[model samples]
Target: MLNIMELQQILPQEYPFLLIDRVLELDEGKRIVAIKNVTANEHFFVGHFPGLPVMPGVLILEAMAQTAIVLYAKTKHVDKNMVRYYFAKAEIKFKAPVVPGDVLQIEVEAEKMLSTGGILKAVASVEGKTVAESVIGFSVKNIREDKT
Candidate 1:
């Protein structure tokens, strides 16, 4: 399992953008399972809905995508600071609304890898039931460091 600090070392996202709280399971290039502790205090709840706050579907997808990125990075043995994994495409489905205080468990599996990127199958669940699922795609590129 990975905590926030360790996640920060591997993930490029920070603060509100950093969705997944911890990685519970990992299989290098094959698969990964992560968690997102959704709470009422989340900034998005303020504007997402005042009376009936719900975690946005897109953010759920993003969480799944981010988890997939970690799998991609680990499989390729590339430092996250040196390589950028972009969200290239996704075919997603939202089966339920994720609400406050819900513990979202995201699982990602590598479907295939190409020269330019790879395809991933991800699912988000709450209490063992799937809330969202997707076939996600990612494109990896080496960062061109600026000499400043």
Candidate 2:
């Protein structure tokens, strides 16, 4: 439902840090499904392993978090330009290694929402096999107010 440009408008991450490539589906306040096209040229692959490159587990979780933030933005109708989303917590499990050339599909659902933030359940997979899953939380702050 959202393309890379649209995602860039909603998310704060830039190149090399923006993990999501495109969003395939989103149910406003409830859930989202996105994709990350991992490639051999990713910078992380250089040091993560010399001969064997694995997409970092943390980045997979980050993709999930970014997906959730998009849903939160849509659900709350908050302006990304006016606010910042902070990843607050996560409890994750890695089921497999994610390597280059794998299209990582991320799925996230809203578990609970508070005035300042919310909790979400997220999962990432490659070709239908789950690579990582987590329950993550985040908080949003208005940037304009913070400057005061």
Best candidate according to lDDT: 2
Q: Give the alpha-carbon lDDT of every model.
A: 0.88, 0.91
Which candidate number would show the highest TM-score if scored against the true structure? 2
Each candidate's TM vs. the true structure? Answer: 0.93, 0.95
Model 1: clashing residue pairs? none
Candidate 2 wrong stretches, greater than 4 Å: none
- lDDT tens per residue, model 1, 6-25: 88888888998999999999
